[model samples]
Target: MKLRFLPLVAVLLAGHATAQEAVFQTKSLTPEAALKAAQAALESCRKQGYQIAVAVTDRTGLLQVLLRDRFAGAHTVTVATDKAWTAASFKTSTLEFGKDTQAGKSMSGIRQVPRVVAAGGGLPIEAGGTLVGAIGISGGPGGEADEACAKAGIKAIADALEL
Candidate 1:
């Protein structure tokens, strides 16, 4: 009887150890949520006296929402989307690449990735250490300013999501 019970306990322990659970499960933003993110960022940028373009990308780096404030240069929209894609795909801030390459770290491989901009202004939207996606902003006075706005938008959304 003791030997039989030992096998049962061993099996239970193994099952518990191998129990798999979702980590950073993917989150899909409702259209309203996406719009709010864009709008809030736009308002924030305007308050700072900057006309900016903002883009939100999904976990896979695909465009989910994009908006460009009136008077923002067309180029900004393109850059915003590209930066968001880069961050979502790389699972890190685009600023990381900028700093790394500026330090002469031989970014040949990184440069080869067509979607990567290696510029500041894009940040990953993470939940529990897992990347949910990314947001990017452009058309501000500087890339750092754009990055700040993007981060603010991400924070707003993260708060709403209760993450």
Candidate 2:
């Protein structure tokens, strides 16, 4: 009986060693920071004479702020949000992801994933080398323009995010 109990005790000890913590910590942008990013992106696009929409998401790919210019198309809302979500989820710029997922590539299948918009204008936000959030822009002339606006948005808040 003692020998049998040894196995049970060993098992319990092993389980304890491998147990995972019930809680953990994560970092993400505050609402004010997110809104600032969105506003900056919008202003950038406006300067370029492009009516647009901007979306900012926290590290978890959850929307934190969204801003649409007065004349931006209705579709821009969803596109901007999806782009931000894609960037946060993939932890990469949507422009690069779009190229990598092009047809004939192994990652091409990722295009089929809902909410994964493999396009430009989506960029991950990093602070202290850790991803803190993402920003996305839509309704510019094309992907490149949209991406430029997104970059401006990040630049606007870079100082605040630096650790």
Candidate 3:
């Protein structure tokens, strides 16, 4: 009986080892691409007569690039960065996250998390059907305007990010 149990344990261990060996590949946003996205977002807002700040972050919520228009307020920079971080960390747009959190009593606690900006202007960046980063805009007159700038940033790089 002891010998039989020993063999079973060894077989299980071998299977576990094989499962642990399985690996997956993931992609992340590059600094160059992040810069382009930020630039486009700022440009888009400028075209609309809005001075704004834009930030881009990798999948891990690490900022890769930031841009501030000449007349943007100082606070806009931090808001943009936090918005990008929040979107990347949560895997969704800040606008959607904010609405959902507000509507659900249990999820409202998410707003207390550090660096979580529950607002518009944050959007996850996707490449090859996977989330690779996020872009955020701030300093616009309203959330809608800020979100439009963020969308323009993603649109600028959509072709390059295609699978």
TM-scores for all candidates?
0.78, 0.86, 0.85
Best candidate, TM-score-wise? Answer: 2
lDDT of 3 by residue, 1-163 (tens): 7887998999999999998789667799888889888889999999999999999999988999999988999999999999999999999999988888884667999899899999999999999879999998999998789999999999988888998
* Candidates 2 and 3 compared by lDDT, better number: 2
Question: In model 3, what lDDT does residue 107 have?
Answer: 96
Q: Model 1: residues >4 Å from true position, as ranges?
A: 1-25
Q: Give the TM-score of candidate 2.
A: 0.86
The runs of at least 3 residues in candidate 3 whose Cα sits more than 4 Å from the true structure, single-residue gaps closed, are: 1-22
CA lDDT scores, all candidates in order: 0.80, 0.93, 0.91
lDDT-best of 1 and 2: 2
Best by lDDT: 2
Q: TM-score order of candidates, best first?
A: 2, 3, 1
| TM-score comparison, 1 vs 2, better candidate | 2
Relative to the true structure, candidate 3 reaches a TM of 0.85
